[model samples]
Target: MNCLKKTVLFTLLLLGISLSAQTVRKYSNEFMNIGVDAAAFGMANAVVASTSDVNAGYWNPAGLLKLEDNQISLMHAAYFANIASYDYAAFAMPLDKESVVAFSAIRFGVDDILNTTQLIDDQGNIDYNRISLFSTADYGFTFSYARALPLDGLNVGVNAKVIRRIIGDFASSWGFGLDAALQFETKSDWQFGVMARDITTTFNAWNINEEKFAEISGAVEGQNQELPETTEITLPKLQLGVAKKWVFHYDFSLLTEVDFNFRFAETNDVFSSSFASMTPAAGVEFGYIDLVFVRVGAGNFQNITQLDGSDSVGFQPNIGVGFKYKGIQVDYALTDIGDQSAALYSNVFSLKLDWSLFR
Candidate 1:
């Protein structure tokens, strides 16, 4: 392959390795793993079988086959006490009565972080006026297509994605991956779906400027600091979901979904992890026809070994509400990460438009 392609692949690999470390800098493209719309967020990401809107571009492409009209959606979230933000946009167009295609993008970042030097001036005092600012950002672009199979109520889809990561102006990496999905529905409105992400073990190659690192970490006397050439790889992940809908009155409905995510990587110990490396989630939604929605969910149900060598489990909950008027829709959600204390919360909002309603 060409030089540019090689660099991107290497960067993708780095993303996976970082995630495995579970540190603040663990994942290079961690933003791509975040759910898009409030619906998915509030549902604890149990959306593989429940996605029917533009958010399907990220959740399960096969769900796009449910859209009869052209649609577009935009969403934004204030993450981690407003220290960072995540944004998403998607558009889906029907290719025929049974097929559809979509394009989407996401950006997550922390901007304008102050950069300072440790050097002290006279009297051992540092100069505050010399500080600079830099930003760290991650981006993902996806092109997805879905089509109904000849078998009744069956659909298949795929996503081709490109990813990029940047830390200030000194280090940046690019990578790519592929995702595949399958969805099926029963005559009683029960749905099942499966998705495989980064099916090819996406790879990322890093190109670092050692000079920038030396500036950040002070230089040693008569010693040269050089960056090392490294490549990162991310293994594929599998997620499965099941959803069911119950109709009460003619105008009211309730939807429930359950999801399980499986990772192939090894963990620290058997006590802190499950046999299959699994994470389970469940969500419920109440709707008034197609005009209003309320949702609640809980997930990230895993055990962790605390610093004191004690095993503990925490609760993470999410809630959301939505409104639809004509062709326009609005949604809002609040997600709580209990493991990170009470203050660690994420707020998400989204808007969607359907072109067919106007015509």
Candidate 2:
């Protein structure tokens, strides 16, 4: 096929994947799993135990209780050769000495997609003017709450999520889910956390535009004959993390963390079984007087089958840096460095501001 034909085919494939909703899809609501915050991305998403900022609203809400002041955060990243954009924003504050609350929003979208179903007229004459443009997007809004427990150094949190997904003028879906998390700190400075996502089994109900479907039905021969399934379900997943920070010379510090992500159904994770799968991730950060920071992480371990039918281990590596001053912080992360994994790499940037910055 020609380059233009290839591009069109690829675009349609993406739309098809997004519109294929089922009752129990393994990767339903996957955009939410892409994560937020350059710092977390830098660490390959191993910050659940040590995340204590506004970004924690999406990572591990229990960590929100550690916020000492009201804060706001924003992040943006581009993927798939800039064909898609991912954006995030969040606000967090202490409701009281023992409790905290946060609000977060995320969007991942592909804009200006060409709609070519009408490119050819009834006379079989191709007309470029017949093409139109549309977009496909996914949005998630989370309301998170965290509270300190009566037990010293213990915290618990919960998140209520509203999900919306749109495929231009063709199909749309709305979903809701719940997440629960816990965090604990020890006198030895060890931090531990556990997060349960989609704990209540998230569900999405899709609404397809019959007219649009009919228009495309004839565009591709013997394809899309029937309407897609209207219901999509997302199963529960878990993440466990442990971290510790050590200070030296009263002006330097290092933080190390490890995380285990588990999905109930087996796939190609580092460790897989019929019942569950696990991927291990590790990250480290070195800081000088809490002002300059450097981070490195590795994760997304998978077993890939080579062309020769041999299984090979593959993983993603990430690196990032940050600077903080006067209640403001900026962070940058390069994920999937060196294209070591099957997925594309991305450059992520994020900003954080403490309310005190205005004072």
Candidate 3:
């Protein structure tokens, strides 16, 4: 390998080591999003089954192994009750007859908010009123490589990504992660595989102030405080999963999978910290005429305590469907949670488009 290739592999390893500590940030404000419906993620994101399409970038870069032509995908979604949104653009091509390389950019936007607080009005009079706006955004880059091997029955792939999160007018933090998988084919009628993801990441941070905020709220610090000296939080993120399939005589197949996510973060005042709990998800996929498909799934949630000792908690159920025409396919997903005190547990909805180079 040349220097450039060596650099790529070494950086991939660094992403895997990011699992050491936990984080104090609110991942829900960033990662907890659905662009193609909750059904996609609810099922272990196993879209790698037949990768000749584009959504594979988010689900399984290994799925790229199945692609024979270039392709692109665009996805977007409305998340939670916070008026947040997510957008993604992905494209890929072959680096060689046997290998493929893919690139993608994802964005999370927290629209300006109506800040409300009490003011003195310079008249020594206190009054509650709407204040300034608040919101945040982030960016992620992924470089994935995959190939098919003729080793009897072994087919595997890996992906690495650089993730950065930024808050409104705050210092941004950079993170890296790793994802790997192996798939085995038996009689071409049955396919089985396992995958691991987000093996390393901080998930969130504790603070974003341009400078360290004095803990005493009235303490003076030296010039060293010119730049934002923020507190970084950590999160343990490891996913282990297995999937299987049943193929019909025609081009149709029925697939199912289950995966477990273990969090290493400790329960704390931070939001995403509550997700320190474990999550086990399972679902099935169905295809007809190699063009249309549908899937449904469900899973548990991580519970975190909030003020008044009340926090959001529970099991999440989801469903999704897909349609293919010419070389274009569209996907949709939905996740539902019952209700809560402060706000009724909200539902998440997403849509995704996949186009192949052959088109």
Candidate 4:
């Protein structure tokens, strides 16, 4: 740790704070309170702009585009608060001279819920609140193909995905979606990127053949009870971001980068929100001769209610690190909202072990 490097990193921290001033005076919500898959949520989710690492696959599949070789990654986070847990495993390999192929499986779901429904006959009867954990799960498998077209320094890629969700005693649904990403890196160190996801609205429905719900109709039971009509909402999400990576001015082993993102989508059980945006995130990594990395950053819209004493909330600080080995990669991240927001969160960890045949 050099003094000069620390000073520069501190300066960037100040700038991040200034950006925060402008982020306020907007809005807030609950799904935003629901912690994401990992502590990696620790940072402003600076993961997408990250390069040469497998975690990038989750944040931005296009990240695999800059890889010098083929690789695989696995990640899991123990969600302490809810039955929810996050797990993902993926593989990325170059298919041809200008194409890359990737495969991955992702899962996140609530465990069993207390099945406390009182039994009743066609005749109206009353029952006490029951207690038993019901079953539920959601998993999706995806394949992504990316290419670097030789078009005057312009790089582009496309990724297609399939998603599935299963509700206990309810109908399950599956659908397809696609994403596109484009980037540019010049003779200088400046780099720029743009991406769009969930181009198609993915849908799911409950109470079909697999799970049947008997409708109970009794004027005494209150209103025409239609076992919660199977609803439809768009999972179609969209986000756009730009990044800039700066070479170290003095510390040759270190490099720094900053990114800003704007997100838009409808509400879901996953994250409650009308919209989300992260602007001007900054971080610096003290690299140990290109073998290891120690990084820190701040800023991302967070629910202030998540914190205890503070009546204020929206975006917080994040810290993370990574270790890379031949055919093996590991990553970890941490987020701090403040002491007022005492609810501790789980850590997000991911690993990727891949092999390339025939050199």
Highest-scoring model, lDDT:
2
My TM-score estimates for the predictions, one after another, are 0.86, 0.96, 0.68, 0.70
Pairs of colliding residues, candidate 2: none
Q: Pick the candidate with the highest TM-score.
A: 2
Compose the digit string of candidate 2's lDDT tens values, residues 1-359: 33354357445844474355877876789999999999998889999899999999999999999999999999999987777899999999999999999999999987777788888999999999998878789999999999999999999999999999998788889999999999999999999999999999998999889888777676777675777788999999999999999999999999999999999998999999999999999999999999999999999999999999999999999999999999999999999988579999899999999999878
lDDT of 1 by residue, 1-88 (tens): 3333333433333333333322222233556777898888888888899898777979999999999899999999986456677989
Q: Is candidate 1 or candidate 3 better by TM-score?
A: 1
Superposed by TM-score, candidate 3 places the C-alpha of residue 305 at a distance from the truth, in angstroms, of 10
List the lowest-lDDT window of 10 residues for candidate 4: 23-32
Which 10-residue window in model 2 sums to the lowest lDDT? 1-10
RMSD of 4: 11.9
Candidate 4 local lDDT, 48-70, one digit each (tens): 44444444444555666676677
Ten contiguous residues with the weakest lDDT in model 1: 17-26
TM-score, candidate number 4: 0.70
List candidate 3 stretches off by more than 4 Å. 1-39, 42-53, 115-131, 149-153, 198-236, 249-252, 264-278, 301-313, 337-359
TM-score between candidate 1 and the true structure? 0.86
- Candidates' RMSD to native: 7.0, 2.0, 10.8, 11.9
Model 1 residue runs over 4 Å out of place are 1-28, 118-125, 219-229, 268-276, 337-343, 357-359
Please estimate how well model 1 matches the true structure, expressed as its whole-model Cα lDDT.
0.77
Order the candidates by lDDT, highest first.
2, 1, 3, 4
User: Candidate 4, which segments miss by more than 4 Å at Cα?
Assistant: 1-43, 118-133, 205-224, 227-231, 235-237, 244-252, 265-282, 302-313, 337-344, 356-359
Count of clashing pairs, candidate 4: 19
